[model samples]
Target: MAFNRTRWAALAATVVLAACGGGGGDIVPSPRVPFTSLVSFGDSLSDVGTYKVGTVAAAGGGKFTVNSASARIWTELLASDIKVPASCPAQTGLLPNVPGFTGAPVTNTPACTNYAQGSARVSNVFAPSSATLQAAPFNQVNIGLTAVPVTQQIAAHLAKTGGSFNGSELVTVMAGGNDTFMNINGVSAAAGGGAAAAGAAVAAGWPTATQQAVAAGGAAAVNAAATAAVTAMGQAGAELAGLVKTQILAKGAKYVVVVNLPDVSQTPFALAADAQTRALVNQMVTTFNSQLAAGLAGTATTVVQVDVYARGRDQTANPSRYGLSNVTTPACSTTSPANPLQGSSLACTTASTIPGDTSGFLYADSVHPTPLGHQLQNQFVKEQLAAAGWY
Candidate 1:
């Protein structure tokens, strides 16, 4: 039989085209962008060490491992990719809370880069004014009593650089989680305690007004409160997104990555609630994410919105896909099921975690993610940044 060289060449070409057709074209090369400095603004999820000096000594919303000598959040992981130091702007002049000691206010050289703080919101409804900030005890550091809102964080960055960007910076914004929860709780409290009492509770730096309201109401009343709370949170979230555009994008920021809130109801704290209550919290999260996405539809800045809400749900639903074994349980131990968020010993290592497997758990406490979970979040950010060619 004669060897047909022409037919063999044609067959090889056909096989090559066929292989390229099956999802090979989907691999679009990332168009590289020159992005230098990295600026982040958000709450505890993105905070580096704004609360390292706070007087609180609890987990979840209270001061925990994200401060002091145990600071390892997503920002640090992301910054390491660029060989940049992940020191908090507040650490320079901030004074750490010393047990049984009182002294004059301490100041350090301004860093003006990482301005994230735990318990920070898009708008500090509780401490709305500087007068209120000075009077309240929100922070024990140099930033003062007010929880620096995402807006304030951006403002501080702008103030440091004379209110302008050089178009060579990569800005990261991950706020609205605290805003969502605070609005829901505030509205829930207002449903039963009246607006004045709810306002008073927040002013006093107490967050139990919502639980007090829930206790006073029946199932129907509670459901109604939840609905109202979701609506309130959605409104606030939309405004926060708008601020990101007006404040960051409008200020000449070229690259921006904004992360939406995840399903907080899936957290250990919300998981301890009644099924109906958990459903309401999840709904509030969805509504806020939707509103935020809608608000940032056509911004001039190269804005990339990461849907963390969906990612969290998927990780819980399919743990093994993300190499996770326990999605519903907190890595840290707790004494109270009624208040799961108030857990203890967030320091997760090979020894501290139960079953001696900290990598299996999705949560470190009632609300925050484990160190492994934080790494997963950093992976998500990396994927988005690479997709947008800003890595």
Candidate 2:
């Protein structure tokens, strides 16, 4: 007989619920514990709308997906599934110095708690389109995200809530993609030129290197950059784990779900990269996930790990199974004048998408997901949460 995925899922969920002491006779089991609110931290993948201002707001685009009233990212979906308050940006702002672009100053929303921001890194303060990179050479256009690192995001939350969780919020963390991107950019810069250029890249939070390595240039420089980038990613993962343990858990957080990095090497952005760059990205992701797992090894009771990497690999390998039609092509039109960031999904909307229907596409742009992709991610998270009896 043909396998029924829905039945299989239901059976698995029942089994998990039974193992967690739910009633075996019940067709649908209740959650083990109720979650009061959802507190999120990370980059664009989890961002609800930290940069929904000025031109981006005018174009009805934000959250790094095909922006619309119904376009909810994974975090929002998770909030709804768990029956918690709707997620909203904890902070919002965009101050771009680019011509023809109007931006709003940074503002804090005390009532909201979704802290994830587009282009945010795990610990690094500098990120793409960040206010830190708005000077001369980088000249990031569109709205400049604050790009507050995840470490500080937690700190800000603690400061806001009197430095401790109430043990009822469902905390989710997903970051480090931007850190990998910075490292890759450093490698590219090192491969292209002398110590001065490489040093500048490193100064932008790319990676640190010994004086000799920076002065080496050539293949030596490339190797040094790659090594540094990989090492830094591992450190980032460890840092995130550390934050969860010492900051969140120690402060009274009970249900924390840590999402590992997805295999970005399979994204359209990486698909456009050379073989060497793609390989480097894969290595960086591997190193980060390994370190994160190692750091969180003994915290199984309070922490649940979501393997987005494995899920992403499976989805890319078998898109049809996930109802994805085009995993390789972006659904957004890169040349549309309506999108100030050009191809960035942060500004993509229904008006700027490709001619055909894009609801089945996996990606909205080169790096960011479409609404369908976000839904797949939400489903994956829900399954994990259910298995852990947290939803």
Candidate 3:
């Protein structure tokens, strides 16, 4: 799935042509596109709660941000601004292996259209908290995320909509964070020399050879694993862009807003990693973003690209400018016994935050954004959409 330089260069050219409107067709202006529905697809960042049942629901936990009736992720906030009905999860379920949490069978809500789920990757079926990866030797504490990749999320939407969009829906996509995470985990396992752990990481679609290479321990093997993981990340980005063009746009979606991956290396999650690992994670994020931008450049008219990476970096560099008081510390309490998913923003509430005013904090957990952080993202997306004349 790796893309060579020539292919990317050609794709970049397509972006230029498309941005210019393919030979500058007649300058015809029309009324703003009427968006009656806000359709969304991606991971936890945009998730409106695909796992808001059982213990998670009882704990008032669902979306990645602080869980409360009033808490709104960026997508939900955007839906409000667009004058559409409040978005709800297209599906809901939780099949965790842990006790005390009652597992809910997967249920579909045809009326809702937000397809984003926590832990979803771009195209990979296996992801963090997924049943397959949480089983046996890995035995990750089950949070019960379905982790249905964005590719299938789009398919589910198409199937429910009679195989095509109505062209009036405002679609937003934000994924690949989990893909980058899986790659990082793969690299760690391969380098740590744990065969079982490496095998489990391979379930996320890193080549099985990575596990074998780990067994035959050496710096060269570890480097090979890192290279393969990064290459796969770029491929995942390209795959997402291809899905957007072929599955979404080709199926009649007129307004597609694709939010690129943010720099996860800047998140609190990376603070625990060594310098080398953090650098590797940064490389993976940039690589994914680059491939995604190149792949979607050709459809500039219909696709709006939101540069979240740049925004995140800016927020990190100058937190005060963004009204953020703390960019490095997570607002949520990662050490709460009452919280079933300790350290996860999913279980975080106003009562569970670190002491003092957390309203200005940028993160809710190691990886998810706080409400204010989501607001910034919401504002950023609206700005992008307005600039593209698609809002």
Candidate 4:
């Protein structure tokens, strides 16, 4: 399938990023939009806590692998800008936490207003923009649940009064994991006893299936769904980019950055059940990315895709180096039932928890990043942001 760059270009999207195919894969962070603020949109990875106490699941607020410093990804990007075209050291609430260095946070959206919410889907909550009369998720700021997809999130943001942002102010998107998980779990349910079989395998538990549809070919089912998901996400990316360009970039948002999907096959959660399954997961992930690249094809917009998966793709080979603790069971210990599995780490504690740590590598439970895991992503995001000139 020849990649259709024509359509992508038709949308005025432009990717300044270079191919990551060769050499030792040097870190490439993109230049930040030199804007006053970075209004984010998406799920847990980007969610600051829009859904925190709203309770689709009633879970706590954003506590994933935050560096604990004010330097969360967004914050860090804005932190040390002695060289940024013409900006002050990102004001309070700007970017995220700063690392190793802790102090009062300088904010980009200091009004306590950044669109990001932990665990939020692109379209979760149908959250209204009035701010005063928001949805359950918006009230607290969890961003998770709402069990929505990325496309919807974009629309919802557009619906908000202040949600409409432009040029540089809207920085990036880090979403779509839950969509994949939901797809995977749906496939598992199709195979009778699939849930129980998967459940019984590791000490930690797998997500309960909401559907009973199985992949026509077992693991193949997951592969098919993955392909569909990638396709859907790609289409969503293009469409959302359309909104970004017209609504934000054209008006002034300047740049719209997005974090690419990582290697799905590499996740311990998928691999633990079956080695073959793992390989399939990885393969589909790669295949899906190809489709995604095409979807993001030729727009004049600066579209940079980061290989976040590569960072964790070969974890078995080098988990320790990336700060990954590489555990087998889903972060949950069979012996300790009291520990409520949180994010991807499989560990139980909330704050003390970091992603990729063996403590919860298996059971951080949320089908997504444990705060520690997010730390790993933060590293990838920062590096890519630099590569994309977001620094």
Candidate 5:
């Protein structure tokens, strides 16, 4: 769904007084299952140091997006709270088949617990190479640093765990955000081609009013963009559902928490775009989440879906409830005018911030969350784990 700023602002103002003390209570450990480990697989949101060790992101005096030891991400906090051993995994090698891209020429270590990578996606393993690896804008790492998609990350974990879970591991999976992002980026790459493709199909007797409107550009190709994104997300969600079923649940995983894609339409990256572009991005995220939710429905596995999307939207819509002051702009400073959140987190210390302070800002950069944002995210996931009886 598109972001309704006026409506959310009204809701925020209306609930200001009522929500003063309505925030959820502290997270309490569950007694049902004494989960001993937190095995995570996802994107940068859950990554520990895959990017730092594998890619050039950390080469230019830039820290990995999730590398705040003092203020770690939700997964790190969850690991610490649940007492899971921390490990960092890195896969540095030449992409199987990319021109002029040398390998990192490094070996693997087995001490890594968090297999998540910064540019990982749900379907990257199935594909030859990820969009992040192939796309020029993302190929900053001259020595091709491959992103271990969730699929491959699980494979990496399974290689270590031998495709078997002891039922004591608290598996955390948060993917599909990059999947949705790549699909949205696909729309931009195609430009008006979506409209052209829809018009061609209509000309070939595929009669649909939506296609007709697409030809007229009445909806600015959003209909086509949404459809494309939904199809991609549906496929990704299906693969994710299958993986969770066979690789995780069937292998004796008892407590699995999968975080849904957040309302990225409200991220600084989305806000930097025009209103229509923001709406399209929002539509892509919502469609991805909807597909993922549907794929995870009616499963007997003890899989909990954390509604991070709703939680993030609520935090932005009602910042007062979360003690947030700036939910729109990023705390990091970007020199690029086109992408304001491109500022390096390593360089965005409190001294370098636009306001010289990041007290209540929700985001650290264009997309990633700040320490406070990560804390809020951890709280949400903790509540879900408590509700699911997974300690």
Candidate 6:
């Protein structure tokens, strides 16, 4: 979600179209069946197509709090497999499940909260006794939604007045990427000192690997963030499991799966930006996953680790292999730097220092992925969701 700029002193945080993908390939696959329902929550990654949207508009053209553009996320694609209720889309469809609720499951249940806003953090933005996206049309048939860090999401669910909200009964995650972004190195310039120097560096080809290595240094910082998140998740997960034991498993909900994050290093940002940076980021990802695995040790909740990064790289390495010769996004060049945050070296824009496509898989505007790029991610997500029983 955030990236570092080599020219600048400090790497400014910017949300990329990281709409990255990782369909649970090889490492583990899904059972290829729908859950009780399909649902999602998180930052841009799991925004379920609510990104840049105002609100879910009757499953057709509409707008919301975000920009007026109507964009449906991968979740909409799930209709091919999951069953969606007709009266429950584009708005809150949740009715109070029991006594505590006054026919209102949540305080702020909108038809579709998306739950995942751009650059959103893993915190509860819900109100007690309020309905969430569960009853909405966008994802009503697919599954339920929950943001990551797991703890906060559970807190909101547990606090609800109505019953039927238990962590153990469902998948316990919203996917992870911000964790990886936080681990990247930083660049600063005494507030405003490096602009000129940054320009000079650009004229020199800007040493992509070196800048990336610096980002790699951010691993420690990210580790600290992950540690805190993991600690909080463990405590929350245990409580959720207890609730599941009482409600779902004890009652009837089957299989509690906790998805593990993919290798963040393989994201388009890491790849286009710098090789050294990608390596460092990958290492940090490995470290964090190990820590997360340790936290999830010996639990009945199955941990599904999606290998998106490696799979993404494979797509990049031989894009043509996937029928992406003309459709794939381009990567890296002076005209279009690896990332917008990593703006072109001064000379690059002028067609002087850097020029034509340096990396074949990058986009002309290096930051966002091409349609081909989005497709690859779709493939990965489809693969993993099926393997992990997401249907």
Clash count per candidate: 1, 0, 0, 103, 0, 49
Cα lDDT tens digits for candidate 6, 51-154: 11111122221111111123223444333234432111222222323333122122334443233332333332221111232343211221122223333433
* Alpha-carbon shift of residue 320 in model 4 (angstroms): 4.2
TM-score of candidate 2 relative to the true fold: 0.89
What digit string (tens of lDDT, one per residue) describes model 4 on residues 126-218? 221112112332232221123334555454455553655544453566554543443343334334334432322111112223212222335
Kindly list the per-residue Cα lDDT of model 1 for residues 238-324, writing each as its tens digit.
Answer: 977888878888889888888888887777656655676567777877888888899999963489888787788788788888878
Model 3, span 323-351: residue lDDT tens: 87888887777667645676577777886
Deviation of model 5 at 68, angstroms: 4.7
| 256-355: candidate 2 lDDT, tens digit per residue | 9998987877877777666777788889888999999999999998898988888878777887788878888888887788777676788888888989
Clashing pairs in 5: none
Candidate with the larger TM-score of 1 and 4: 1
In model 4, state the lDDT of residue 188: 40
Q: lDDT of all predictions, in order shown?
A: 0.56, 0.75, 0.74, 0.39, 0.58, 0.35
Q: Which segments of candidate 5 are over 4 A away from where they belong? A: 1-25, 29-32, 54-69, 90-106, 125-145, 192-226, 336-352
Query: TM per model?
Result: 0.73, 0.89, 0.89, 0.58, 0.76, 0.50
Which model is ahead, 1 or 3, in terms of TM-score? Answer: 3
The total number of steric clashes, by the backbone 3 Å criterion, in model 6 comes to 49
lDDT of 6: 0.35
